[model samples]
Target: MLKHGLDPADRRRPDRLSDRELADRHQAMQGFLTVAGPQLDQLYNLVGLSGCNVLLTDAHGIVLDQRVSDGDAQQFRDWGLWQGADWSEAAQGTNGIGTCLAEGRALTIHRDEHFHTRNTAMSCMDAPIWGPDGRLLAALDVSSARADQTERYNRLISAQVASTARAIEAVFFRSSFPGARIVVASDDPSEQAMLLAVDRDDLAIGATRAARRALGLEREGAIRPRPAADLLGRQDDLHGFDRGERAAVIRALARAEGNVSQAARALGIGRATLYRRMARLGIGDEPARLSHD
Candidate 1:
C-alpha cells in the first residue's frame, strides 16, 4: 500500500474511464472480449444466485465486460465495479482484480483485506488470464458484498474464478490456432493448462504459457516451430534415419491397407527387403492380410 501510494483511510470512489476512452479500450480488446463473453456469463450463472457479480478486465485492469444481477447492479456500480472502471492496484489499491493482475495468480481478498477502508465491505476473488502467446491477457473476477459471504465461501468462488480463467485461455488459444491440433503437454491436472498447437505436418506452431515454460520456450513472442513428436519425446522421424524409414513404412502400409507387396512397391523396395526393414523396425507382420497386388 505504501509503494502504491494508497492511503488506507482514503474513501474516495475509484474513477472510471470516460465513455469515449472506454470505447477505444474495448475496441482494442474486441477479440478477447468475444472469446471471454460466454465464459463470463457462465460464471455469473454459477455464482449470481449467491449475490456475486462476474467481471472480466483487460490486462490494465479496466473492466471490459461484467455480469451483475439487476438488484445488485446499482450497488456494484456505486462501488466502481462496473464496466469502464479502473481497478489496477495503482488506482484502487490492494484489491482482488488489481492484486491478481499485479501478482499474476489467483487470490481472494475478503472484507478488511482491502487497502482502502471503503472497499472492505466487499469480498473479491480473482485470477489472471494468460493469452495464447503466453502473456498476461486479462483478469477474471467475482465480487460480493453480501454480509453473509464468508472466507470459506470466498475460497470456493476463487476456485471457480481460476477455472474459468483457464477455460478462457484455452478457448482463446484454440481460436488463435484454428485448423491446428491441440495436444495436452502433461497429464497432470494440478498444473496450469499446458497445451501445444500442432500443424497438419506434425510441427508444433504454438504453445500455452505452462507448455512453453515446461518446454523451455520463449515465454512471449513468436514460437519457432518444432516437431511435435520431438517435443513430446516420441519416436520422431527427425531423430534418425531408422525412425524416418519406420515412419515411411508405416505410412505406406496404412495407405496400402496391409498389402505388403504394394507397400514395398511404394517404398521402391522388394517385398523381401520391406519385410527385413519391418522386422528391424519391430513392426508386426501382417502377411495374412497382405495382397499380392
Candidate 2:
C-alpha cells in the first residue's frame, strides 16, 4: 500500500466562505475577466486538445472562467463542476485550487486524491499565478477524468499550462505595471531570477534587483549602472538572451546539482560564459565541487 501522503489519497477539509466573502470574490473576478480579452481566448484554443478542462480562479478560489470540451461541459455542469463554481477545498471540498492555495505551490491531484468524496473521479493540476509584486493573483488549472489519466501525462500537461500562464503573466505585468520594477525571487538564490522594468510604452527600460541577483552580484551597486544585457553576461557578438536562457540556466543548475562545471558542460557553454550568465542573471553561488583529479 502506498503511504498516505505519498499515495495522493489524503483528505483535506475545505474552508467555507461566507456569502459576503463570496460576493467580494465575485467582484474581484469580474475585474480580472474584463481584462482577460484575447489572451484568455488564446489560452483556451491552445489547451483545447489536452482533453482537459481549463479554469481560471481568483486567489480566493472562485472560478472566473472555464473552458471545457463542448460535449464534456454539460456533463461536468450536471456534476456541479461548471463555470463560476467554487473550486477551493474550503467551499467545494478538497480540490486542486484549494489545495494549491493552501500549500502555495504547484500541485497535481490525481483520481481519488481529493478530500471530498464527490471529487474522486477527477484529476487536477494547478499552479499559482502571481502579480507583478509576486502576490497570489489567481490560479490556472487543467482538470481531466480519472479514467485515462497518468501521473506522467498529468505532469506534462501541467507544465505546459503553467508555462502558458507564466507567459500570460509576463504580458499582464508589462501592461499593468508599466514603468514599475518587477523581480522574481526563488528559494534557491543560486537560481537565476528575472527582473523586468518596462517603460510607459511597454518597452523594457531597465532590469535591476532580481536580474542583478541572478547574475551573482554581491553588492547592489554592481548592477545598477550596467546595461541589462551586460548584467546578463551575454557577449556583444550574440543577440540578447531571451527568457529561455534563464530557464535553461535554472534547469542546468538543478540537473547538475549546482556544480558550475557540470552545469556548463550540460548547457554546452564555456564555463566562463556560464559564470558570466549566472552573474548577469542574479544566480547566487553554489558550493564548489571538489576536484576529482
Candidate 3:
C-alpha cells in the first residue's frame, strides 16, 4: 500500500459482500461446506471461548462462512471480519486467509506482520483445506482481536487450527470415494500423514494432499492408476497378483470382446506388443472373451 502511494496509516478496510455476492459465494461453496461443516462448527466453538473469530474461505479467498462468539459478532463486524469479507492476501494484505492461500501451508501472522497498520494489533492462524483431488478447497482460520491477543496464545491456537484442517481434508477424501481402500504409506510418523485411495485390486487411483507431498509430487493429479506398491516402498506386496501390464491388457481385451486389434487400440499398444506382454506374463493360453455378459 505504501508503494502504491496509499498510506497504511489510513487503515481502510475492504468492502463487504453485497446480498447477491454473498448468495453467489454461498452457492459456489455448497460442496465445500458439505465436507467442512462439522469441522467448521467444532472450530467455531473452540475459538468462541477465546473471544476470537473463525472463518472459512474458498480457494479464491471469498468468505463462505464467518463465525464469532455470542456477543462478539458485532465487534468483529465493526472491524470488517464479516461473512462477506474478501480476506485473500490481496484483499486483506498478509492476514491469515490470504497469506495461507499464498503459502499453501499453515502458520500464523501476528500483529505487525499485517500489511496495513490498521491490522497491526490483530493476529491470525490459518490452515489450508483441501479436496480429495488434491486441490485447495478452502482455508480455515482463527483470528484474535488485538485487545486480548497474545503472541504465546496465538502459537497455541495455530497448532489447534491446523489439526482441524487435517480432519477436514480426511473427511473430503473419505467421502469422495468410500469404496476405495485407504492406506498410509510412510513408516515415519513425523512425515505428513495422508491416505492413498486404491481400487479393489489395490491399484492406486488417487491420493490426498499429504501423500502427494510425501512423494514429492508438486502438482495435482500426479497419482495415476498404478500399483500402490510404487509408493508403499514394498516390492513384495506386488508379487501376489498378475497386475498392471497384464491386468490392463486383460481388462482391455475383455472390454474389446476378444478382438485383439480393438484391445490394442483401447490399451494404446500394438496388437503384437499386447500379445507379447500377455505371453511374457505367463497368460499366453488365457481365453479372451466377455465375462461381463
lDDT of 3 by residue, 134-231 (tens): 88888888988857677788888898899888888887777777798778767765433387888867688878888887776545855667778767
lDDT of 2 by residue, 70-126 (tens): 877875665555555667655555578878877767888887677666678888888
| Ordered list by lDDT, greatest first | 1, 3, 2
Predicted candidate 1 versus true structure: per-residue lDDT over 60-123, tens digit per residue: 9999899999999999988999999889999988899999999999999998999899999999
Segments of candidate 3 deviating more than 4 angstroms: 2-6, 188-193, 216-218, 237-293
- The ten-residue window of minimal lDDT in model 2 covers 1-10
Q: Candidate 1, which segments miss by more than 4 Å at Cα? A: 189-192, 235-238, 241-293
Q: Output the better candidate (1/2) by TM-score.
A: 1
> Could you tell me how far off, in angstroms, the CA of residue 4 lies in candidate 3 after the best superposition?
6.7
Prediction 3 global C-alpha lDDT: 0.77
- Give the count of colliding residue pairs in each prediction: 0, 14, 1
